[model samples]
Target chain A: MQNLNKPNFKFTPLQIVQISVTVFVILLGLNLWTFYAEPLSKVLSPYWNDNLIDILVLIPAVGAAVAGTLLTRQFEKGETPYHIWQAFTIGLWFWVAGEIGGMVNDALYWDTIYPDFSLVDMFWLLGYFFLGLSLYYQLRLVYGAKSRSRRRIYLGLVAIALLVSAGLTHLAIKAGLGEGYAWIILFVTVLYPVFDLTEGATAIWISFLFGRGQWSRPWWGLILFALADSVNTFYWLGGYGFIPVAAQTVLNFISVIAYPASYMVAGLALLSNYFILRYGENSGLLKVAIKSEINKP
Target chain B: MKYFFRQIEDIPLDHSPVSAEVYFRGENATGLIEKQFNADRVAALLFISGTPGMAYLIEASQSKSISLAEFSSFADGVSHTRAINLPDVAGRLMLLALESKVNDKFTITTEEAWDKKISRWKQEQRSGLVEVKSKNLHGFIFFWQGELQKLDLIFSTPQGFVSGFPKLNALDDSAWDVTTYVHSASAQAYQCTVLRQGAMYWCHKILVRYQEMVGQKLLKMMDRELNRQMQPWHWNINLNENDMLDTHFFPYLMDEAHAYRALFMAMGAQMNFVIGNNLTQRLLSETFEQIRPDERAALQSQRLIPAAFSE
Candidate 1:
């Protein structure tokens, strides 16, 4: 076949896809194995599930750092691409720090969970700030030509974030969610949904902007993260009897698979971004990433 | 037509008004014109001496709005016949200097040859004029205190700024000129490079931001990297001092826009490596954007920022 004559580099994309899929399967399988498989479910329940979450989340976080290092070399340091990758790198590691902290904290208190305002939240929150910076630069690069539209996009995303976060918070409070917790804990507890929804909106927008390309998967990966966090928030809001029977079953399903799935997707997203930029750039996608050819309005 | 230049009778040693003195004057120099180039061979090869030099062919035909061009730029669409009659007191007050004292001892053809010669000259601490008398290639280059100064090597002599340096491939000349020994002292050859007025603010901003971002030690390392990349391209822009950019002189480059782009590209790269790229790009965009619209327009007009700063 003529395909056989192609250079070895061509297969890298295939290899990436295969390896990522394998990782996703293993992680997701480990998280879900307790439910479907007979005796293995009992064995893996708390210990293996915790381990899976750590591995899944850390993979993407570390991947972001490594990707940042590699991709930084490819671009001129003071360029848009360089800034975007660096921000992402720093931001992702912040999440990793939080994850590591949470893991350690959990290990120390095997029997009990930390309070609502754990130190881990601090790292995760800071991660959002840097991650926001990366997105700022990333959007700056594309929207330079006729940035009025870009301004509108910003306004629109912000409005959506505000509306959704307000609605969710109100609903969360009304459902007797914070009745027992301290008011301070309640304030922090509701912040996750706000952040997650904002990021979800942005990721969905970015996904649409990029279309169904190799790069879109990473945004989708973040979407999973947002989805998982939202699910966690929903469950906290006295979700019992709050939903239809079928919908409640779906939420339960989401609860089981969502976090692990989010970590796997998000981590792989970072690694994939690196691969796509470095080795999978033959598709002319990076040009789109750094410079937008969208017609001026 | 034939033109012969008669050397001026020696002026008193104290009389050093380079603009007024006619060093070498010729007559009927048009007939000696070589066909390979455009522009009429002017009646005189006016041999004037100073730091970085400028040459003008003030045709007798166009005495009205007389213009002076840099020595390296050739005037096009004119005939040798027009240059037969030279105009005096026209384009004369303007100052363009050449290295008066030629040290033609080290004649070089290729750039590779020139590199070795320059190194030898540096080792020997040689100082004199390096004359380029190859057919139509007439540059009065000089060395000062073991260094062939940037003025003699750049295109900034005519205008205040130079775009880029000339590469060996860009030479387009067959034989290199001789290095004639004239001045042994370094006093005369110390012509400071002139930079564009508005380019000052931006260059200062860039260098300062870079310094602040990368720190002094790494900044020196970046300077070394810049020179390393620029050397192979036949440039001698020494960025040892950051002050040079803010003052009247920025280490100038001479020649095409593409060559200038390479210098900027290299500089940008060094900045990125030393500092995070966001700061680098942000500094560039922010500085460029913050300047007055007129200043920005002036810089863009001069193409002072290379396409490497395209983003």
Candidate 2:
């Protein structure tokens, strides 16, 4: 039987370091430019937190587009798995939708935009759907044809996540928010986090199955992304007074850092995965140890 | 026409001689013959005639015990069905007359003569005498570790060469006694006997020829689908004289077109036919469903049949 599980290659240690440093430098430079440049900040002041949009949404969205395009081209040439290319394409569309929604929100300048259900929420919901789909495809590729057992486990976990998120939403509703903002709060505070939690948990599960030795770099990157999303969720709930504000200042700083960090890490993960597929064999990073036991002479 | 029979209870076990031989003369005699001794035992031989496609010879063999009377009866029955005319029945009538005269020396001479005739017969079959049909469909069967790994089908149409492969599970755990019938509207009918042992299913012998045009088309299709250059005509296993004694060879039969249609119909009925593309799947399903129920059932049965049908 063919060993389909083996990758073509992997990144070298130096390449890994170079990629990490490049991402860090880019993010740090963008943050410094946004915060310290007086002339730019004054000019963009009219555009509803242009700095936040640039850092949290635009940069990562572009990265996703690039990664998605590369994956699609590879798929057309029969160089990548069908599911992987499909997942990336969906991710690209998700980002495009979100970017459009962000622009719309900025133009309107609605006061209730942050904690309210609006057209932006619809885009975000769609984004969640695509993200879930991407994760599902990745899991399917890993599991292969004899996937009945693994699929049951995955579905079970998804059920648990739904239950947990539903319970959290119920508690938040009981805490007594105004009726006018209840639906909005339910969507933003409850639904968004539920999607994030489920997607993150599933990604973490897939990464775990990939094993620590073979794909630890991408695994760590995924963990960072998942952690950032979780932190952002907790921060949103805290702001809505769904949790006790014991360490409010510290939580606020963490949330601020995490929101942008999640997007950056996800972009990096996409880039790294593409590199692994393209250059792992040449770099000697992606070696498939033949299962001698399965194939005995 | 003379017929002879010799039975040895304690035959010298060094090397088993050719089991059976046949020689024929006529217009329709320029074809192959396949016969099944029982449900699990099958024998096939090609016999294209020499010099103006007349006077053909055929040989059949088995490793197990067989009734000579039953064998003679089968040949008689096939000759009747096929409307073959035998000039004189003196040889067949002499079986009882020569039973007492059959000694080790006579058995050795008969075996040697049959072997020599079979060698010449194989050479004649390989000669460029058989007609090659243009724009005909072709099929290739691949085996790995004695198991049927894949079956590739390529059809030559005015539109282009259309090709597809059935899913892996299509031949999974196939019975050893399964016989794949190959026939088309414009081709002589042939049969491939499948043998299974343990988890592996394979053909002990095959007589289909490979077409270069079909191979080229298959290569192109594989390249397009996989984005890799593949030589569809290349056989991983050796098909030389040494290998022929043990391993099966993909027979290159003459004048057979659309042979894959019969094989696909037989296999599709027996196993799940998962085509790589959906359009091909939809197109082929109707044709696959048209296979006769008895034909389908013959290939599907796990238990061996009392008699195996061969053409």
Candidate 3:
């Protein structure tokens, strides 16, 4: 009887155009960042590529990811605009940090290590990281959730530890403390991504299996971030040669289909489960018993 | 003519049609139009109440009358046994009709599919009359039109609300007739009734109170029928008030009278209209009161009791 099909509001022509342009700019910026900035930093100083970029970008990215998790918690409470803003902020900060790391790596680290590195190259690298960071964070913050103080504290601590570790790793390398200790600091920086990815995945799996399905909002955001990171990594390094590229292209095609295909599968599962849930119950106790059985191992 | 039923299913998808039709007339114009224009093309497909995914079209043409036993079997075949709760069969049928029309060509736009479905079923079915029947978990007699037999009236005693329908083949029956033929299989009988009186009363009240925007004529017809049947009778009083009454009532003076059989006829009529099937010929055939009680009893004797329960 009620018209559930109608959306709350229709987008105007100008709004549609704006969104299209924003999306296009974001995409172009990302390609430039990946193709130019990332490679240039590595070319300038191979040693700094592995460690410095992780410090500047990786830690902040982890913080942004944690912020996404916090925002999801807010969303469950029915906070809409606040949730969206928080998610955006988390994504923004993480991306900004990552870009700064890239810029500092190219401008300061490369210039110091290699006398041939020019300021023009440094500026280009800075612009590249800035553009890429903006694009990634913009995408991440789409779902917007409320910010949590505890998460903020945790992210700050992580940032402080990363900066201190980066400085210590640089000092130790200059003193010839050897690659073993530098690798230890490198491992610390890597922990940011590793921990965020693991937490996000765990939250998603747990919510899906144990918690109400509605509670999986944060998990979805994290999953998206993890997926994007993985894809970007593969794309940036040009990891695939001609043979791998062909294989991956096919895989990507399947993956694209796979995304929408999952929805159809989910719909069927829901319909079957609906009948079972709606009719099978006799007494209230029987309903409880049935639910328990469904939840069983 | 399309007859609308309420609260057909517990869960409805974001986009799904919800209506059914019963054609008593020999023609299947509605069925033809639906097949020609599928409804799902414009809208995303949603599940039918009991069926797996919405299959859409169900034709209850006069060419093939679905008996109570067959109705139960067809319903069971579609619904998974795990979920035993039955949705309103009439409502489910309408939902099926809506789904059947879904296709790329038929539903080019939302209004094209939805408004068109509503218009065709309602407009076409109103011109004719059809007789249909439905059932419940426990045995009781209810109908969209007609009278209840005495024995059935007593057996299906309602704690609060009650309704009845005459058998499709037995419009001539009198409830007061004292004979074994009333209850016997050879007499006019029915397996179940369609609209439960209690539920219908509630539905009527809600519609009248909430959906005042619907047609006034329909509201008046529903109200007049409700008031007529709801009268408390300490003495025998002919409840018929309209000059051209399609339904008749007979009080059972003896225990042998069969109200259940009469109730089935009325339910069948309701089902007929609900599915957008024509029923004018059946309603106009020999006046409602002209059918003798003996003729009604004779019709009951011909009905076959299934080897097992209808469920």
DockQ score of each predicted structure, in the order shown: 0.04, 0.03, 0.00
lDDT of 2: 0.37
Off by over 4 Å in 2: A1-24, A32-49, A52-57, A76-80, A110-115, A141-149, A182-188, A212-222, A239-258, A275-297, B1-311
User: Residues B1-311, candidate 3, lDDT per residue (tens digit)?
Assistant: 21121112212222112222112112211111111112221111222222322222234320122333333233322311111112223222322223222111121123344345435545543211121212211122221223332222311111211234323223321221111111212211121211122212323332332112112222233233333332332111121222112121221112112332222232222212211112212222212223344333333342311111011
Error of 3 at B27 (Å): 36
Chain B superposition TM-score per model: 0.38, 0.19, 0.20
Candidate 1 TM-score to native: 0.43
At residue A44, candidate 1 shows an lDDT of 57
Summarize candidate 2's per-residue lDDT along A1-297 as a digit string, tens digits: 111233434656337636765876577556544544544547656354564545445665666557656535433333224455466556656656777777767667645445366676777777677667666665654454356887777778667766776677677667874355565566455766676667767767755544432222333433554566676666555553664566655564555455555556555555554544344333233322111011111
Q: Which candidate's lDDT is highest?
A: 1
Model 1, position A18: C-alpha lDDT score: 65
Greater TM-score among 2 and 3 belongs to: 2
- What is the per-residue lDDT of model 1 for residues B32-65, given as tens digits with 9 covering 90 to 100? 1111123323422332211222333333212111
Q: How many pairs in model 2 have backbone atoms within 3 A of each other, for residues 3 or more apart or on separate chains, i.e. clashes?
A: 13
